[model samples]
Target chain A: MAYEKPLPQPTAIDAPYWEYLRQHELRLPRCQECGHIFFPPNKVYCPSCLSDRLEWVKLSGRGKVWSWVVFHQRYFSSFANDIPYVVAFIELEEGPRLMSTLVDCDQGEIRCDMPVEVVYDDITPEFTIPKFRPIR
Target chain B: MAQMTLYDFKDKVCFVGVGDTNYGALYRTKDPRRNQYTLGVEAFKAALDDAGLNKDEIDGLILVRIPSYQLFADMVGLRYLRAANTFRGEGRMSALAVQYAAMLICSGLCSTVAVVYGNDGRSVGATYGGEGEGSSPYDVLYGMTSPGAAVAHMWRRYMHEYGAREEHLAAVATSNRRHAGLNPKAVFRDPLTLETYLTSRYIAAPLRLYDYCLINDGAVALILTGAERARDLRKPPVYLTATATCTDLTFFYTVDDFFRDGVRRCAEAVFGASGLTHKDIQVCQIYDNFTPTVIFGLEGASFCKYGEGFQFVQNGRISLGGELPVNTSGGHTSESYMQGFGLHAENIRQLRGEAGDRQVPNCQVAMYICPAPICAAHIMTRR
Candidate 1:
């Protein structure tokens, strides 16, 4: 049986972030000058203060549901059986928001500001997708 | 800064040719680029033929999806004297093209310009389902699947924030459907009722099946030339009097106000440039991607004050023969959902007095609002 492989493309700017994902760590670049955290890490300068000094920091993997939607339509063949899935933008404790799928809870139970924690799902041998589940 | 007058570009440029292909459910074979090229070629040929000119005479080309600096010149086989790529929302692409083409013509760098747009949503195999590149990581992580889901989130917020009822939005859908019934090219011409709109299965909370624009494959094109030379063309020229665009930097969150600030700014600027106000606009081709979008635009454009847009439409003020006839060719709601391309083509028809059943009598001026979240407005007049 031929197994389908999920594709992951990483550029130089994002390689470090993806590398961290391999270790089950959520890493983002924080501007030492402005104390701002940015995702999809960039090189050299801070977008906020144009400061060159930056540091990579691991996040707490906890956040609150800022907004959410339940999609009844399947957008991908891989997700066809996963219809009526819940997608949300969670406001992390670090002040940036992350988009992820909500799992382990009924769609009716999801609400704004609901507490959630990140959970990793290993889909393929080399890949893991980040999903969120209600803390309760 | 003085208050700018609206409808001010009296002798700037004019539309010489207009063409469009059928709009319907997604095509099964064509990709987006092919759809664009086919529609571009058809509209380009028709415009050139209609003007009794050749393709080589073209000096400028403007497009939305493809960049001008890319292989567009090679692919289209025209060495443009000038070219522009507009990356804003799709609906405003053509209108902005018209504005840029006019500037090129006015600057003497180009005598003739072609503005084209096309999309084969059906044939592209995506059908609003597949994910594209560079989507926000936040959006992808949360399983934000389609535009419907995102807009539904916004719609729910708007309803909650403004106390807007579902029926208020249903009126817009039903009205567009009623108007589409008179448009021969409209895909879903069956008259829709408020009950039907309300009862339809939800794509997301507070949004019914009818609230969204059908993702159809279609293309529309227009030719822009100097207004002085417009009279010699085969088609009656529709004068491009004024155009303006405004953008809000805040992407998803900043626009949570939903009052359409960018749309209001564009409308005010265009109207100021043309020396005309919303009252002077006899016909309007407002973008209706989602029903509430129209209501938001109507209010934001100052056609009516905020909170009064629903009442204005409820009183039959936007229908044909009403105060301000809108989307007579069914707009995106009933007509083809070529993004905002259908709205522009319909505007041209109205200005030319060629709109059959839905024509507003003696329409001297038409205002087209393309709200991409980033908003643009253009005022065209009968020559």
Candidate 2:
């Protein structure tokens, strides 16, 4: 067995979104009334229209590097060996954003607004971590 | 969308009594009862003493991070309690706290309100990451695990966008340390230089140890009463004129404007309400949870043009007697990181001309800006 890092516990509202990730797909809730798309699969209502009507929809899994950070110090023992790894906010084409590990990307080569695509990794049988790769 | 008129609470309510526990006392002490509650009680008693009023006279209370307000109200032996609420210290607490106090007073629901904050965050072994239970949910897997990491991302982006030099970040840390040297209440008063700042190891790239705030323990309390009765207590009055709070449901571009989003909204609301501009501010006590936060706040509050913040503090302009003397008590970097609680206490002291060595002369107006997911702001003026 491999070491497991802390994983997000999907609540009832967000379970379906995680289920989609298990199938190697990225999706979020789109507000049916106001047509607003949002992330984390936990939103219960349209943030703009104040309507609780929403539906799960697949995202294009595309975005630009809105921002990035390289942690020089290990924040957790699970990541002690992974020092100097990149974490970034992916501003998706559909307007929602997700926080994910940026892999297959050099720390020196990372730039703001760089185009990227999502790649999924099964960290554990119970978890599939969604990561990003630079669009070369 | 209609431009809603925020009911003018300008100069309607004023901070009468303010109190702070001795800095670094509990952070350094191993005493059995050096927790937040005891510190809060001490601060509350100090405020009551400063105001020369009985504890029972306070009809309303607002506490941050110190759970169970009913227990506090009971401990104070206040027979008549009219109103009380708790605001999350994790967000724009200090600014929102003063605003809530003023609103409660003006609405006639509470004649006098006590806004109190107590935190032993660092002393209690609370880690500064996603693992911490009291703050924003961090994604540990992605290394978006702590505020330091998140701010590192923002700082790098800011630097890349504006062409900021390493010296620019160093100047902020260097100048704040000099200010801390003058404040007896600051936790770290040792002098810091540009050379030292440059050499400090990085916690997260683009943000060195020098860029981070100290974790310590302390409590701050302020008493708010109608402006009519403010003249009867304490040294001088710091009026709450024009306060605003606006939240961006998500910062990942769902709310546009990147780092400047919240501050811009708060700045518009506050300045729009009052006839005051950024130039009218004599001093500013911005939230310094991270060094870049100060730079972003300056841009958000319209002190300078977008991306001009790095250049604004060039040539020691943010030091005492500079174009703007920011965080005169070293702020969170050199001072205690009581979140933004200390900034409120600093605002009152500056207005009262009691900031000792770091006092900005003619301190007529001051501001505290907490630019976060929840953008909140407060402006204080002396009449």
Candidate 3:
């Protein structure tokens, strides 16, 4: 069956971020001026200093769960089957946070500061979502 | 040259009249025909009646959620205005309306400005979530669609950080519902105990159904004028001594610091300008879009130390007749959610001592806090 979930359609600025994910690599934009790394990867300039000198750098894909929540309400019809799934804020070792779902972990055992690492969900051939799993 | 301090406009602009739709009566009146304009006009006329002023006296108009200023002004017959504007219906814009009206009045731009808000969200089926709604498309990408989910993430961390439990979150809802029992205008007056709150299914885990605000249709209007003009009005004037706003949009709709910096900055300016500390605040109409927001508001406003918010609400500390009664009108959780419009009205009522049954004894000072990403706070005093 074709993937039936919402996927991030890569724009011109963020196409590289998605392309990197396709190759099982996690990368983000780093400011050459301020050394500030940011997410959503659609920025044309550094958020901190507005410098146009930006470079995409590979990330370690290691982080900790800052916080997590279980969704009991199905806001999207596609997510209705996953009614009680966990979505968490994973604080990367590089000092920025990203939102993703936790996999291979029991809901009852998840802790706030639990160690986690990046895992990819290639739901479709074209798109890959970077999820997190507890680093047991 | 001397600096023009924030205190320069203190007590210069005052709220002379406050009015709202029969929220409880209109609860869940999902008639699409009941639009914002009809509700706005209803509240506007009621405010005019409360102030004993004619429609002709309203020269300036500020609208929220209600789309156009020209249409609202024309419908309400507000001609010869010095200032007229509109703002999106967000929690912060409610207090910003008061700040802008104060600016217009103190700068001699306009007199007797009417700030109005009318939301038919429930009527028009505003889910406030899901695809194509107010949330970012990135939010929907992960099935994290609503504001409640973000707050749930924060509360989960809060619980882990402070060793707080669901009972702490329950304290906020039950206490607000307890106050709602005395509020004839509140929407959810049915008895809600901690047990009910605990067992209620989570919309987003850690935050249950009762933790969220109701999506009801309602309208709120407040009449503002110069202090001199307010004195001649029928009702006692509730002086808007100070107002401030601090925004934290750096984190893409989520705040890593949980709105601590924004609330503190706004609180400092409001407290310094009004010359009233937390102890002097007899009543607080803190925005309760979600129960966690109340915790953040109290903590950020310096009512308690950071991370102590869960405990600060315990054992009737925020109930009526407690050290400081919060959301005496039941707030957005129990009372009808008018975004933040109803909260501003509740503050005026508390300062005017018109909040019967749920009135805090010897109420002299009341504060309104909206602790969103773009947080705002204002202090009102009885004159």
lDDT of 2: 0.80
Q: Candidate 2: which stretches are off by over 4 Å? A: A31-35, A44-56, B1-7, B132-138, B251-259
B93-182 in candidate 3: lDDT tens per residue? Answer: 898888888888888888888899999888887877876775654556688878888888888888888888877888889889998889
Candidate 1 stretches greater than 4 Å from native: A1-11, A15-27, A39-44, A57-64, A112-136, B1-11, B22-36, B48-57, B63-89, B131-138, B165-167, B202-208, B232-236, B249-259, B304-317, B321-323
lDDT (10s digit) by residue, model 2, range B3-76: 44654677889988888887755556766677777778888888888777678789999998788787777766
Largest DockQ belongs to which candidate? 3
lDDT of 1 by residue, B279-304 (tens): 78999988777777777788879888
- i-RMS for every candidate (Å) is 3.5, 2.1, 1.2
**Second chain alone, TM-score for each candidate:** 0.88, 0.94, 0.97
DockQ of each: 0.30, 0.59, 0.80
What's the C-alpha lDDT at position A88 in model 2?
84
Best by TM-score: 3
Q: Chain A TM-score per candidate?
A: 0.86, 0.94, 0.97
